[model samples]
Target chain A: MTPACVIDRAKLRVNAERLKTLCSQRGIQLRPHVKTLKSVQAAQLYAPPGSAITVSTLAEARYFAAAGYRDILYAVGVTPNKLPAINNLLGAGVALTVIVDSEAGAEHLIAFAQQFSSPLRVAIEIDVDDHRAGIRAQDPELIAVARKIDLQPGLQFYGVMAHAGASYGCFDISSRSAMAVQEARQTAEAARLLGEQGIPCELVSVGSTPTALVDIERPGITELRAGVYATFDCVMAGLGVCNYNDIAMSVLTSVIGHQVDKGWVLIDAGWMALSRDQGTGSHALDCGYGLVCDAKGRLLEGWYVAQTNQEHGIIAHRDGISPPSELFKYGTTLRILPVHACATGAQFEQYHVTDDNDCVSTVWPRVNGW
Target chain B: MTPACVIDRAKLRVNAERLKTLCSQRGIQLRPHVKTLKSVQAAQLYAPPGSAITVSTLAEARYFAAAGYRDILYAVGVTPNKLPAINNLLGAGVALTVIVDSEAGAEHLIAFAQQFSSPLRVAIEIDVDDHRAGIRAQDPELIAVARKIDLQPGLQFYGVMAHAGASYGCFDISSRSAMAVQEARQTAEAARLLGEQGIPCELVSVGSTPTALVDIERPGITELRAGVYATFDCVMAGLGVCNYNDIAMSVLTSVIGHQVDKGWVLIDAGWMALSRDQGTGSHALDCGYGLVCDAKGRLLEGWYVAQTNQEHGIIAHRDGISPPSELFKYGTTLRILPVHACATGAQFEQYHVTDDNDCVSTVWPRVNGW
Candidate 1:
């Protein structure tokens, strides 16, 4: 099988330990987002059973919950239709916390709370950098939403949380460190506002891979959340958050054919295997779809997957040099480091865990879809 | 649940019927590529059992073969490593046809064919428009590669096949029609070249969704191959190959929240649900990610999914108009017609086949990995 997802367990452990050490040094609980590698087996190394975890979908929450992860945070903003599933998780003795960033969102939860036998734990998502979803920390609606959830008989206002998603754009350490501090300050400010309004916030959460690894003290934040760091990608490397060697996951593909005159080496791994996440497209040194590597996980200098169709990837030199005949011989297996780990990892149903000897030590199955 | 892949059976049948009628009128076989909707159940409508079909991966070949599809064509260029899987299919009595475009590719097959008690069927891929993987139609190597496969005792020289992948770039009917003719002529030319060398070609295949839809007589082409036509997409609509109404597949998502100041409405369907294929980015009307539609699949003019994170899609108006609060109310389900149907379709494990009234009539499971 040429097009297979491979995970280097040695590199994965190193990446996982790096984050754990950073969070421990900062005296903050690390709630690893299992959304990257939605495998109970992979999570066992970092976010073991009984450890708090963050998930993007209810499916991951239920899956991890069944694996004995009691404290879970469904990071994505919750909708009314998903309430029954959340209630079901609560009924199963899982301390699941759902996030809301709008007053209308709170209203939906408030209306659906009546059917809940157990109170649904809710958190107000604060917009630290106006990145994606979340309400502004200074917005009056933030306090209104928190009050609504706290007043609802079937709801428990768990805390205030924020993700500095904009931190991903910071190319240098100083900027990322500043973004991490701002994320903590704004989220803590939201909690401070809630306290002034007689709403005590238990957990103040903030993070993103770049921010979490920034080595800055998140003053009021009790917990940190980051996903892609568990398996660093080209995007993280482009942002200077990690080195390319730290990337744990890659797509192992065999050289299928080549377009000699055009200097193209076609492989079996395409967007279907590498994912179409060109996360480093805007960077100074763009790693097209992914950075190309040897079968043994060694980086092939200046080579990357430039283009991809559904089932074909074109590997070309960044400098337009023709591919060497010996290296890209027919049936030669090559590893492609993904541009985005989470997106690429989601493409496969399982991960072939490789040991230091590049032997398949184990196969880890992962959950996909909602 | 929101963020599910939905297929309108009515539209799907109409699209299938359109292609079937065209192929029937032209007196050619239609070997529908099952890569878009990998479900054997879905293929039963367009490509039914006993009908020759094409697959992207060996997993799909084995899947459809188990469902009684005998004449399977492994379309992607075969590598030496996959020969065992190919042998397994042949051993199971599948009339599987593998393709090769280079001498090295043929050599790999020639060496591995000795292991098989039965001969391996091999086809020479003709590069019609220098689009992707294929030997140029008139290249001297085309005849050389054909002779090599024919001379090998363990291999049977099947025929010539070509795919007009460049036809996707043709934005008008006239241009696409011309590309279609060029595709047919070049592929047929390769078969004719093989015929002159005392090697009788068994098949002459040429197609692409745009090329297959062109109502032109493919003089020497024996069969037409297409995949996305079973469920047209925004890219097809952008190319004038099909209408948006003809797109049968969509990602059903609920409005999770809104960034009112930014005129953005966020949905649960992100790259994880609707893949990161921006195939229409170069078109006159770039459907960012995908075009928006109502829950019942009515096109919402000017609305498209502008950006996406892992599980969050930001739907915005092309004209920068604010979202109408009434229509985009919290938890209101909406449909998104994908930029590329095959890419979006692959993101899901199963399709929620919807009836005329927008109710799910059945669930069709699809094969994912190789």
Candidate 2:
């Protein structure tokens, strides 16, 4: 299929089961972020009815809502361009919740709610540890916004929310724990701040994939929004949350050409197939392009795709590593581990589910477009 | 337009004219490689009357042939999956010239030509510099295969063709030029070898974007194919072909979020908008993500996007260099230069063309799904 993406559904099921067990053991409600696996088929397997979901864009809320997902949270700050779409989906009987940070933006969402016959649910985004797209944890603006929402017509202040994306940047447990602790504390304080202002709170969303796995308590966190945990990548592998054995997605490609004299094995998978995601470069180890794997799922020992073109991939043997074969003969099918599963996974419209036996069981379609 | 690809038509026209003039001065025909721009609008502009065009796939050959352009050369090694498409295109009065390396592949094309009941022009690829594809220069088997093609029914032997793509990997001009000279000499020898075997050889194709503008001399070379010359990029900039000012295509995106503490700015132009091409990184200097530029058509000072997710980009100052703005305010438009024009340009279905004055000129649709 043009050397595009292929997902392993069986592996995804295993990953889902593992994460659900992890959350159950820790007594945390899992509200998986749907941004990673955008396919309704895959989402249905991980998040069934009564299972909460987190969406990055309102467009995704409409998509999953049409597919029978009634409860959804727009994780990103709602924009004006998306208000009409959000209203239509809500009017159609889907329960929607959105996030906002600034007073200027939150006032707009509140004003839009006034026009609707039905009320709107929203959460104030608090800056946890990563100072990105959120208000300060101790700012009076948090209570001020809560007070405004209390007085605004047709608007409901759901609670406080925060994203711990900075946990992925950490290379060790002590550092990740430090970041995760800051994440849970800041979100907990913001929720308490709004709660102290006589505002009713419904949810306190605070967790990323890395933070979800940490053995730390999110005291005020009500829902965990972990998406990429469904499809582990090299970045996750480097963080020690998931091992190489847990990766559920890869790009299936074929060896189409070669630069033998220069020790380059050209494959059909370039960034189009396996996205040029360098997320794992800062980790203790760097996976070049990605971990080169054989058709049988063994890592191509000593082999690394050092250079690439638009449609062509050039690979060579790493130092002290012996190549498996003299040449990557024509029509050699291979699987490449992605740097970020979400980025690479979005490029394809369907997933080719290869089971533990490596036999394709089914094909699931993914949704795209605005 | 959803932060998709934006093409500078004026600059593309300028690059096309510059390359055409350079080739014309050297008495060489410019056969623009269609894989670069891939847009019909860009292709039509580069193509003069009866202009020879180079394509990497049979689908491209057919697409161009149906669009009324003839004299097409399928540059990539012929594959079994593509034989039928090539045969049908040849039958449609298109002067389809295809390449052959292995005897089995050549015999397969011969069989397809016989079944189609038309004479197909064929060229034997000679390994000039890059040992990526093409047969060896002094291979006795290569000459024997050329001879057999002449005796075969429904096929016309043209000449030899070679591409020094490896020269693009050469950071120094002397090495790149030596690679060019080697390509020219070996390609000319392949033609001489074929002529010695009583095969009528005419055209000798040898050219690359890295060498097309500098080492233009190839007395034995008859035709040249340099497509990337039309839309230069950070990769071409590293090759010393064109500067950042000459890059004709870029992705126009808006800043959607930022992390003021970590100094990380998230742009809407993720890999989906900028593409996953890292071809420009292999040079002496790596263009992280790409050459970051502003909405007003100037390079963004000190701001380089170092990381990206599916729909998110993390822009930071290079080497801890401080930026002027602490916040990349929501909805600030930006233009991102791609590392490879060919790969990034192929991701979009249409281009929003703008003039030098930033005025909208025209919209051009690209043909894909071959």
Candidate 3:
């Protein structure tokens, strides 16, 4: 068997139920981004008809649409090349919603919608906390682009959308809450500004994994989109949002070699299986390649290997986690706590779903490519 | 096409010929490690009688042996689980060799050899620089292990082996040369010490990309086992071992979106296509994610991608490289210079070979998993 990616079904169910309940009490739509858990089974767990979803790529948007998810939002800024695919989905009776950031994008999308027989719903991406891809809320160009594109016959403007992606960089809960509040305010203000121009939007959306867990009481954020909550990782743990036990997915690895003198244990899992986007490595507590666990999912105490290769992970004591009662033996199978669930989960083509026991219950194939 | 991985045959041929010539000048065997390339076609480029090659895994050893390259060495330190496979390879009339550092590993190999009809060659792995997996130089237990295992029928002690992987950490010519020297001396000294035990070591191999590039004057060293030089990357470029021009492999990516307000450019190539391994990030110059280029292979000046998601790369400029370029239009295909060639190359299953004119050539498939 390929060193299959394992997902804890119980943990995922618990996470989804918790988030769904959280949104229910706050009167917000919990549109769980299925990108983090790109499984039909996992998607079906939370993808109800009215459950709005946020997708990064059109491939995902189409998949969810085919699976009966209607209110789909392509959260990333759409490009000219991908317009045709979006048009096809919209034309095929899928209520496809997209995000636009520039006048060029708005114009390109508006023109594309003109070719279509029906209107295309789109969210004008607003700059929130992260300076990644969005127009500033107060920028004159934002209103101009919106007005010009909304004036186009076939283009339907749905409101402003913003992602507090930088909220993930926050070290404390107050900082995350502040970022979320600001994101909600900026998006709401943008909607009000557009409303003054006689344009009313049905939905306003704002989201991020870090901001999702906060007491979400922000105004005008009708929908919430979060992905990593299904499977938290080291980065999320380092942020103090979730504990290591809350993480659902882990890569199973085997010990291949040992350095008797240096007390270094080498495992077969490398950067290929465990991704190298060790974003949390630069934090105050740098977990080496990953947090190591024994056969029964117990965190190995007094031992942490700090370096990795393509197929080999070196293990040693970093914070007095070595010199335990039992040293890792060759052929011992272990699980790696992934740093980024989204990135590490993308490494494998499928997942081996495991329930309470360590037995593989079922297999779930994943979709890849753009 | 999902922006297939491309390998430069011309560049690989140049690097291969250069390494072989350097070794010949110093009267050492150029046993190119097939672990890096993982291509049967690439392995044939250096095959001849006694063209001893090193492999990182038993699967790799089995691969090269089946290709009729009998003088194979599985360079990774062996444990007990691989005994059957090693014995099977020997039984199949392949001159299989393996490395062992612990008594348990040596005993396992010896027991397997006793069960097999054909003789198995074993090499002692010496801790040359206190890396990860090797026995210490002055360990008295090595002699006891060797004595207990060598005369146990159908087992022949091959020699001593040491890898100078740490040499890649060197930043300058002198430091690199010093590292190579360190690798060579330790490997040779261990071989001499073992030979004094009447082991009659026939091959004393010491190698890595850095050591193979500069050092050829190690006492008692008989062979070089470097592999990664086939496809140099940003890490090797920073180490001054190979220039960017010498790199033979790159990922062809496409522009998916652009965001001027955030100073970011999105591409189809993310961690899956272009791996998140930033091993080369902290060198003298940090190549953000990777080096960027246009569709036709023209270099992007003053710009680099700062971070990457699963399937989305967010590129930005430090010195204000024009965010708007004609070549960066939607769906523009570009070749990304990888950060670590071995790690990045392993992420893909197949390679799309193209000549200088960008004409598609033959596809090379690679083996994955343990």
The number of the candidate with the highest lDDT is 1
lDDT of 1 by residue, A113-183 (tens): 89886888899888899888998889999888998899999899999999998987899999998898899
lDDT of 3 at A179: 85
Any residue pairs clashing in model 2, and if so which? Answer: none
By lDDT, the candidates rank as 1, 3, 2
The per-model lDDT (C-alpha) reads 0.92, 0.74, 0.75
Candidate 3 docking band = acceptable
Q: Which ten residues in a row have the lowest lDDT in candidate 2 chain A?
A: A320-329
Query: Looking at model 1, how many pairs of residues clash?
Result: 0
Please provide, for model 1 over B1-370, each residue's C-alpha lDDT reduced to its tens digit, 9 standing for 90 to 100.
Answer: 8899999999999999999999998899999999999999999789988999999999999999999999988899998888998999989999999999899999988888789768889998888898889998779999999999999988999999999999988988899999999999988888888899888799899899999999999888899999999899999999998999899999999999999999999999999999988999899999999999999899999999999998999999999999999889988999999999999998999999999988999999999999
Best by TM-score: 1
Off by over 4 Å in 1: none
Q: Considering the two chains of model 1, state its CAPRI-style docking category.
A: high
TM-score of each: 0.99, 0.85, 0.87
- Per-residue lDDT tens digits for candidate 3, residues A117-165, read 5788878888887546677788887788888767888888778888888
Instruction: Tell me the tens digit of each residue's lDDT in model 3 across B5-99.
Output: 88887787888888888888888888887776687876555544446777776767777677777888887666566677777788778887777
For lDDT, candidate 1 versus 3, the one ahead is 1
